[model samples]
Target: MIIELIVCFFATVSFGIIFSVPRNSLLLGGGIGSLAWAIYRLLPEYGVTSIFATSIASITAAMLAHFLARKYRIPATAFTIPGIIPLVPGSKAYYTMLAFVEGDYIGGLELGIVTMLQAGAIAAGIVFALAVFSFGKGIGHRYEGGR
Candidate 1:
């Protein structure tokens, strides 16, 4: 857990750097990314599926992004985009393609399905959070994470 935390924290910071996230927001964005990745890592040990885990973690990331965006007056994408880097299923996608190259059609298909589900879950979760927050803001909630 410690290693995963540290590695993801730095990885998120590096992603922020590469993406040119604002200097004032970079570390906070890294923090959101690290927290989201930690949630993704933790849920699997409890027997939760990766797709569910990814969705939950992504929801958490998006909510945090919205909260922090209002707090700091920065655009939420600065946090949301970098925050999801660690949750991306890069290795799974790679192996899915590799299986096809190795003539393992069934294996490739299974992996491809799971990978797509995880990706969809991430998108759905982010969108759900966005819609919720947008609705609240539109109604003049003024709920800036407790002001």
Candidate 2:
């Protein structure tokens, strides 16, 4: 578990560097990725399906990204894009393509569908987080206007 967290942190930081995220934000981005990956790894022990686990992990990352962005006065993407890297289904996508290359149409089709579903779950989680954040901001603004 410790090793996995370390790997997640480095992976996110590397991607952050590749993405040109500001030097000051790299550690926060790495921390977010590690936390999200921890959640993703632990959920399976409790019987959470991959799709649902990915969604929950993504939600975690997105929330952290928003908070970090506001705290640091930077765009959320600085954190989000790298934060979500640890949760990406890269191995599954690779296997999907491998199956196709091996002429296993049925296997490829199944993997492709699963890959798409996982991608959709990630997107749904992000959207859900954004909507909740926006709603909360709206309520805060409404009350602040009376001050």
In order, how many clashes per candidate?
0, 0
Candidate 2 TM-score to native: 0.89
lDDT of 1: 0.91
* Cα error of candidate 1 at position 85, Å: 0.5
At residue 68, what lDDT does model 2 achieve?
84
**lDDT by residue (tens digit), candidate 1, 43-84:** 999999989999999999999998899899999998998898
lDDT of 2 by residue, 1-147 (tens): 999899889989999999999999999999999998998889989999988888999999999898888889999889888888888888999999999999999999999998998888888877887887777656644555546
TM-score of each: 0.91, 0.89
Report per-prediction Cα RMSD to one decimal.
Answer: 5.9, 3.8
User: Which candidate ranks first by TM-score, i.e. highest?
Assistant: 1
**Range of the 10 consecutive residues with the lowest summed lDDT in candidate 2:** 137-146
Candidate with best lDDT = 1
Runs of candidate 1 exceeding 4 Å displacement? 136-147
Could you tell me which residue pairs clash in candidate 1?
none
Provide the overall lDDT of each model, using Cα atoms, as 2-decimal numbers.
0.91, 0.89
